[model samples]
Target chain A: MPAITFIHPDGKSDRVETSDGESAMQAATRHGLDGILAECGGNAMCATCHVYVDASWLARLPAMADDEDALLDGAAAERQPASRLSCQIVITPDLDGLVLKMPERQV
Target chain B: MSVSGSPVTGGPSAIPHLDVDPFAMNFFADPYPTHEVLREAGPVVYLDKWNVYGVARYAEVHAVLNDPATFCSSRGVGLSDFKKEKPWRPPSLILEADPPAHTRTRAVLSKVLSPTVMKQVRDRFTAAAEERVDLLLEKRSFDAIADLAEAYPLSIFPDALGLKPEGREHLIPYASVVFNAFGPPNQLRQEAIERSAPHQAYVAEQCQRQNLAPGGFGACIHARVDEGEITATEAPLLVRSLLSAGLDTTVDGIGAAVYCLARFPDQWQRLRGDLSLARNAFEEAVRFESPVQTFFRTTTRDVELSGATIGEGEKVLMFLAAANRDPRRWDKPDSYDITRRTSGHVGFGSGIHMCVGQLVARLEGEVMLTALAKRVARIEITGEPKRRFNNTLRGLDSLPVTITPA
Candidate 1:
C-alpha cells in the first residue's frame, strides 16, 4: 500500500493509505476527504477533481491527456502548471508519497 | 443562404442529407435505428426535414458539449434558436445562458446543491425509500413505473423543496412539456404544452417567496436575492429552473433502473450480493437507456468538427442516447452490465451545463436501489412494459413487475 497526502488550500493535510490500481479521486472519495468534488465520479470529463501535484513529485506522474488538458482550462480554480485531474492519476507503489493540493472550488 | 463545400470533398451536394424528422411520432417510438443511420451517415448529417445538422457519434457529441464557446448553449439547447425564434417559454436562466451569466447562476446552484447539503437529506431519503419498498413488497406485484419509480421520488423530492403537497401530481406533466419543448413545435410539443398549462401555472405561483416554505431550496434562492447575489425578479426563475428540471428525469432514471434489473436478473442477483453496487447499477441503467435523448447546440462560429465544417448559427443536434451506445466508445455498448465503469457516458450530459440536479438524482437512485436490493430476491417482468413517447425523454408508461422477497 502507498500513502497519499491531500493538502487543502487552507494549510490542512489529510494522509490516507491507498492501493495500487484505484484512482487518487477514488482514494479521497473512499476516505471522505474534503475539497475533492469528483462530481462526474472519476469520469475525466468534469474538472471537479482538479488538483495541483507537489512540484517535488510532478515529474514522477504520467502526462496529462488531451481531454484532461481541455477540461482543466474550464476548472473553477486557477490552473497552475502542476494542475491535473485527480481522476486521471492511477496509484502505483512507486508513487508512495504522492502529494496533491486541492483546488478551492470545482464548479 | 446555401452552404458551400462538402465534408466528403466531392461537392456541396455530396454532404450526407437525411429526410428524418427526429421529432416525428414514428421516429420517437424507436430511435435506435434512426440513431445508427445518423451516426453511420457522417459526422455531420444535414436533417433536411428539420433543416438542421445532427451528430450521433460519441467523440463528436462529447467534443461539442465540451467546447461550449464554439458550439454554444446560449441561443437555446432546443431546436428553436432563441435569437431567431420565439422560445416556448422564457429561456432557462441556467441552461440557456452562456458564460458570465451561466457562470454566476451555476455558482449559486453549485453552492445550494453542494455535497454537504445533499448529505443532509440522504438519511431521510433512505428511510423513505425503505418504507416505500416495504409497502410495495407487501403487494409482491405492481407497476414499477407508477408505483415504485414515480411514487418514490414524488414521496421525497417535493417535500425536500417544501412544495405544497396538494398538486404535486402536476409535476410530471409540467416536466414532460419542458423537455418536449426542446424539439420542434410538433404535435407532441403542442399537446404537452396544452396539457401542462395548469401545472405550469401552479409551478409559477409556487416560485414566489411567500409560496415557498422557509429553509427549503426555493427559499434559499430567494435569500440570495437579499444577499444581492441575484435580483429579486431573478430568484423565482432560478427556483423555476429547479422545479422544472428536477423530478421527472429522476423518475425516468429510476424506471430505467428497474427495467434493467428485471431484464437482467443476473445483474440484480449481483446487486443483491453487494448493495454498494447500487450507484453503479443506476449509472449503468442511465447509460443503457438514456432518459433525455437529444439536445441541439448552435455553432458560434464556422467550426470544423471531425472533418465536417458547421457554419455559424446552424443548429447541431447532439444525440446523447446514440452517443452512449456508440461502438466507438464502449465495448458491448448495447449490453446492460452493472459492473461496467460508465464514467464518461453522456447520459446526464457533460461540461458546464451538465445536469445540475444529478447529485440529487444519484442519491435518489442509490437509496431506492439499495432498499430494493435488501428486501427483494428476484425481480421479473409480469407484462409488456408500455413505452411513453416524448420528443426528448425515453421512459415507460407502465412496467408491471413481481418481486420475490429475499
Candidate 2:
C-alpha cells in the first residue's frame, strides 16, 4: 500500500494509505475527504478532482493525458504546472509518499 | 444547410449519412441497433433528417464534450439552436450560458450544492431509503419503477427542496417536458409539452422566494441574490433550473440501477456481499443504461473532427448512451459489470455543463441501493419491463420484480 498525503486548500493535512492501483481520487473518496470532489466519480471528464502535486513528486507521476490536460485548463482553480486530475494518478508502490495539495474549490 | 450559411471546410464530401430520426418513437423504444449503425458508419455521420452531424463513437463523443468552446452548449444543448429560434422557455443560465457567465453562475450553484451541503442530507436520505425499502419488502413484489425508483425520489427530493407537498406529482411530467424539449419539436416533445403545461406553471410559481421553504435549495438561491451574487430575478429561474432538471433524471437513474441489478444477479450478489459497492454500482448502472441518451451541441466555428468539417452553428448530436457502450472504450462495453471501472462514461454530460445535481443523484442511488442490498436476497423480474419512451431519457415505465429476503 502507498501512503498519500492530501493537504486541503485551508492547509489541513490528512494522510491515508491507499491500495495499489486505486486512484488518488478513489483513496480520498473512500475515506470521505472533503476537498477532492470526484464529481464525475474519478472520470477525467469533470476535472473536479484537481490537485497540485508536490513539485518534488511531479516527475515520478505519469504524463498528463491530452483530455486530462484540456480539462485541467477549465478547472475552477488556477492551473499550475503541477496541476493534475487526481483521478488520472493511479496509486503504485514506488510513489508511497505522494503529496497532493487540494485546489481552493472543485466545481 | 448550415444555420450560419458558412461553407463546410475540408473533410470528406460523401460522408456516411443516416436517415432515421434518432428521437422518433421506434428509435427511442430500441436505439441499440441504430446506435451500432451510427458507430459503425464512421466517426462522424451526417443526419439527413435534422441536417446535423452525429457522433456515436466514444472517442469523438468524448472529444466533443471536452471541447465545449468548439462544440458550444450556450446556444442550447438541443436540436433547436437558440440563436436561430426562440427557446420554449427561458434558457438555463448554467446549462445554456458560456464561460465567464457560466463560470460565475456555476460557482454560485456549486457552492450551494457543495459536498459540505450535500452531507447535510445524506443521513436523512439514507434513513428515508431504509424506511421505503422496509415497507416494500413486506409486499414481496412490486413494480420497481413506480413502487421504488419513482417512489423513493418523490418522497425525499421535493421535501428536501422545501417544496409544498400538494402538487409534487407535477415534477416528473415537468421534467419530461424539459428534457424532451431538448430534442426536435416532434410528437414526443409536443405531447410532453401539452401534458406538462400545468405542472410547468406550478413549478414556475413555486420558484419564487416567497414560495420556497426557509432552509431549502430554492431559498438558498434566493439568499445568494441578497448577497448580490445574482440578481433577484435570476434566483427563481435558478430554482426553476433545479426543479426542471433534478427529479426525473434521478428517477430514471434509480430505475436503471434496479433494472441492471435484476438482470445481472451475480452483480446483485456482489452488492449484497459488500454493501459498500452501492455507489460504484450506481455509477456502473449509469454507464450501462444512460438515462439521458443524446444532446446536441452546435459548432462555434468551422471545426474539423473525425475527418469531417462541421460549419459554424451546425448542430452535432452527441449520443452519450452510445458513447458509454462504445466497444472502442471498454473491453466489454455492453455488459453490465459492477466491477468495471466506469469512470469516463458520459452518462452525465461532461465538461462545464455536466449535471450540477449529480452529487444529489449519486446520494439517492447510494442510499436506495444500499437499503435494498441489505435486505433483498435476490431481485427477480416477474414480468417484461415496459420501456418508457421519451425524446432523450432511457428508463422503464414499470419493472415488475419480486424480491427474496436476505
Q: Output the number of the DockQ-best candidate.
A: 2
Off by over 4 Å in 2: A1-107, B1-13
lDDT, candidate 1, B133-179, per-residue tens: 99998999999999999999999888888788778878888988999
Weakest ten-residue segment in model 1 chain B by summed lDDT:
B1-10
Q: Provide the overall lDDT of each model, using Cα atoms, as 2-decimal numbers.
A: 0.86, 0.86
Residue-by-residue lDDT tens digits, candidate 1, A1-107: 99999999898999989966998998997787767767686756457788999999999998987667766876778989999999999999988999999988764
Docking class of 2: incorrect
**What stretches of model 1 exceed 4 Å from their correct place?**
A1-107, B1-9, B12-14
| Cα RMSD for candidates in order | 7.6, 7.7
